[model samples]
Target: MSLNEWFERGISKEEYIDSLQKHRDNFLHIYENFSVPTSDSLSNKENIRTIVLAEEWCGHCMLNIPILLRLTEQANIPIRFLPRDENLELMDQYTVDGKRYIPIVIFIDQEGNEVAKWGPMAPEVKELVEKLKVNVPTKDSPDYEGAFRQYVKEIVDVFRHDAAYWNYVYEDMIKSLP
Candidate 1:
């Protein structure tokens, strides 16, 4: 199926958010609080639309999806949400280093041609996450699983409370939008 077809099959913003099994509060917080910076660049682009590949339980999605929602809402850009797991066929097209990543936002024009894309995490946020990951135990260690789970929790906490990270996402996303 075409990107447009996949987008059509995706859920509405409300439906996606309402159906989230985790990170609902974090999603709502970002959705309610993020302020889209004024962008003269997007002002005249009426045909732009976004297809978000995301999952409810993804920490990155919990942080970035709502910001995307607010940004698109303010910019008057229509957006759709596709579950990454169910949409792997499409998601695979946006992989990095052969790994599928969630919260990938594809910007398309009225003709269904992709203009730009942004995803996963902003560079600064990626750096921060990497720094956090340095503390995790090696995979061969007996405590590796527990340490990794703790690392995941810490990452989520950062995503939840860091406005700087949110701003980084907005900056990166805006730079990629046509």
Candidate 2:
């Protein structure tokens, strides 16, 4: 499925926007002094670029895309998106050692050197969702801190242990993005 289809399946535009708002609010509440990193800062005088390679059908993408969008918005960073299948040549240019994975986010520095790459594991998404569901805020319950920490840990693990896939996907993702 495509990104549009994925968005449609997971939530409506209105819902997405609402979730973004909620996410922003929650983020701000905890990080009032936090500032989104600028592209310049991300690159540290190098030209830093970000690319997102994703398919709409991916549940992991569904969960993480919004967070990325929100982060970029807050940080005032520019990002580009490319469909995994549509940009085959570009994919070849940056694919993670030939493996194809959806929803890869790549960070590239000015020298076109890869800085970092991250995405989800096929097994981890369900676990993440289950954990998130348990921590989602409600009138009777609110514990975003724990949930956020867990979420970060899951993401960190993806990059730490899954280096090859992460690197390949990140390379492809960065190449395809604007």
Give me the candidate number with maximum lDDT.
1
TM-score of 1: 0.94
Residue lDDT tens for model 1, 1-178: 8777877888889899888888888788888888887653457667888899998889899989888887888788888889889888999999988999778999888878899999889999899888988989899999899989999889888888889899999889888976
Pairs of colliding residues, candidate 1: none
Clashes of each: 0, 2
| Segments in model 1 whose C-alpha atoms lie over 4 Å from true places | 38-41
Per-residue lDDT of candidate 2, residues 93-153 (tens digit): 5565577766676666555555666564334453545665665564454676676666655
Best by TM-score: 1
In angstroms, give how far residue 142 of model 1 lies from its true place: 1.9
Q: What residue pairs clash in candidate 2, if any at all?
A: 47-110, 96-168
List CA RMSD, all candidates: 1.5, 12.3
Q: lDDT of all the models against the reference?
A: 0.86, 0.49
